[model samples]
Target chain A: MPTAQGGTLYRGREGMWSWVAHRVTGFAIFFFLLVHVTDTALVRVSPEAYNAVIGTYQTPLMGLGEAGLVAAIVFHAFNGIRIILVDFLAKGPRYQRVMLWIVLGLFVVTMAGFLPRHLMNVFGGQ
Target chain B: MTNATHGTPAVAERVGTLDAPRSPYVRKKTTRGNYELYSWVFMRASGVVLVVLVFGHLFVNLMVGDGVEAIDFAFVGGKWTNPFWQVWDLLMLWLAMIHGTNGLRTIINDYAERDVTRGVLKGLLYLAFTIVVVLGTLVIFTFEPCPAGADPELLASFCTA
Candidate 1:
């Protein structure tokens, strides 16, 4: 809960929420990485084997999952840069709130550009 | 002024030398090296590189041409056949695995209140990290774009009949 030592500063603020999101997204990505590596490894088995597995990823359900995965990656990447700035920049702590907003803005723009094109590929009946 | 003048306090201050210790006990030297420090630095460093590598990967695999629909055995075969992509994937695999492992280690250290729980979680984490990295690495290096018996339709376009 908020009773923890470091929670005093981060509790009930953008700092705390962003930190939470980072951890959640990171855990998701790490597990996905394990599965991804295993799937890619199917290439060594045979072309048919690889395609058989990857074909599942092209389904509408998995397309939505891929979108979520990409969204997690985008947010994590931007917020990670924000964290580095907070750690290293002279004015980092002072501007961390503003930086979080910027991170969100970039996340929105990136996903906006990505989703339409990606959805088309997924559901465009090609 | 009176407290300063009062007692043995001023005497001890004057008598104590900077070069000598008041107690005979010696502090033990730290055997714990800067492993955590290096891990911290690696997360940040690898993070920056991963942003580039992962974005490029997604862009190529998902956002280009046919997008996710374009991905399959032939798609993967075509990309891995290129030395540039081979190196790219290899670096991404190792860096991402290590970075994620270290991050999870920090998380386990934070949340796993019990020593036994922490140790068990980290043991599994490292095991998974090793298997994935090894599997991914071998896949990238040993991938055959065109196997003799594979369906030609499944192989990359450039693969000769």
Candidate 2:
């Protein structure tokens, strides 16, 4: 009876964390897409309607949420590539830990590059 | 139903024989060649492309010029007017929809206990995915920034200006 939950909770490895993050981020993005499509479809209605809906997303609170969304997307996309490589390449699983570190490094670098400007846009008084 | 061995004697009999044959169902692996392999490959490929398409979309919409505030009806219209942006958006729409749908299908198959339930849920998911993708593609390609003979008041300012 070798079950996935047989082990203790906090004793998981990088692979476990990556799997968890992938599922979480995948669900997050899917839900966001639902709302995004609905709102964007408002464009077919009228300009004022579309703009008004999008205007609500410009709030400071939504700004933070947007940043979180970006982080989720960045991690998910990077980890996804790693998973893909691990599936296709024979040597991929061997260096998966190293790949995870690389993914994290890239995530941090890309976020650092984008987040500051995004934060400024959100909080900067137009 | 008469096979219900009730009471402590039944429990005692089952205790040391845990390794005995369990359910009547025989688990056999079906050989579905290459479909799953190709699907796995597609997930990675589409995912890689989606990263670029999604990030580029975000960068252009949220980072360029006035940032989030710059997004408006005319803003979208302005983008869709260009063939490059139209193609970009169309690809993003199709790829993301298909990718996300497949991911959800996987989730449903993993958790759904009954075959009927899985089938129903996946059918509904595919239906919604098809509608959204089709409508989205149509809108992207056929969108009229300003419809002819439309009321000027309801239209984007650019239309009248």
Give the per-residue lDDT digits (tens) of candidate 2, residues A6-121: 67544479988888789889978977886787788877877778878999888899889999999999999999989988877999999999999999999999999889898898
Instruction: Give the TM-score (vs. native) of candidate 2.
Output: 0.82
Candidate 1 lDDT over residue span B52-107, tens digit each: 99999999999999998988988888888899999999999999999999889888
Tell me which residue pairs clash in candidate 1: none
Q: What lDDT score is found at residue A70 in candidate 2?
A: 92
What clash pairs does model 2 have? Answer: none
Model 2 lDDT on a 0 to 1 scale: 0.84
What does DockQ give for each predicted structure?
Answer: 0.66, 0.45
